[model samples]
Target chain A: MNFIAEIDVMPLKELLDPQGKAVAAGLKNLKLDAITDVRVGKHITLKLEAADKATATAQAELACQKLLTNRVIEYFTFEVKEA
Target chain B: MNFIAEIDVMPLKELLDPQGKAVAAGLKNLKLDAITDVRVGKHITLKLEAADKATATAQAELACQKLLTNRVIEYFTFEVKEA
Candidate 1:
């Protein structure tokens, strides 16, 4: 079966996100005062061939752990669905 | 009310995502041959003050249009929920 994995890799909440802070500051300059905070991360869409959902999920998990994220600073979550 | 908007900014399907292609190559080198394709994008989380969902959604949309995306090559989608 073919599957699609939507993966989100985010900075650990305990850590400061400079990019987010910068975006918030830019928003304030734009007079978007209502926007109080911003956090930016990576969203990845993967299309792959797998025998089943479980296999696809496992493959995605491995990809996240091995290449998609920096474990010291970021964590990842993913959902696998039929393509 | 305080609201959170989860926004995804993606490269247009017609555009070539060099970053995505690079990741796919890295995955292939890692021997994850089951994965056939990858697309990388930005995921943004926004915290804001708004009177209601509609207001929050509108704020997010405005942010996307004004500062978060390059409309010529990318598009965005968002979901707003109570924070």
Candidate 2:
């Protein structure tokens, strides 16, 4: 079976997100003041061949731990769906 | 009302995703061959002060068009939930 993983990798909340700050500043410049507290992160979609949803989710988790995330500075979450 | 927008900015399917490719190659290097067709994108969470969910969604959409996304090379989608 083939599955698709929709993953989000985000900077740890305790860590300062420079990119998000920059974007917030940019919003201020744009006069979009109603928008605030912007947090930026990475969204990833992975296609995997596995025996079932459980297997695919495990693979996705392993991939997140090993390659898709920087465990020290970032954390991730994901959902698996049929491709 | 306060809302949270979960937004994703993705490279157009037609465009070659160098970052995705690099990650895929890295996965191969790590011997995770089960994972394939990896696509990388940005995930943004915006806190917005709006009149309602519809207003929040509109603001999030505008933000995507103006700043969160590079329309020429990328596209975006988002959902707004109460914060």
Per-residue lDDT of model 2, residues B1-83, tens digit only? 89999999999999999999998898888877778889999999999998888888888888898899999999998999998
TM, every model: 0.98, 0.96
Measured against the true two-chain complex, the DockQ scores of the candidates, in the order shown, are: 0.89, 0.86
Residue A36: error of model 1 in Å? Answer: 0.9
lDDT for position B35 in model 1: 98
Name the Cα RMSD for model 1: 0.7
Worst 10 residues of 1 chain B by lDDT: B50-59
lDDT of 2 by residue, A1-83 (tens): 88899999999999999999999898888888779889999999988988889988888898899888899999999999998
Q: Give TM-score values for chain A, per-prediction.
A: 0.96, 0.95
Report lDDT (CA) for all predictions: 0.95, 0.91
Cα deviation of B43 in candidate 1 (Å)?
0.7
TM-score of chain A as modeled in candidate 2: 0.95
Model 2 bad stretches (over 4 Å):
none
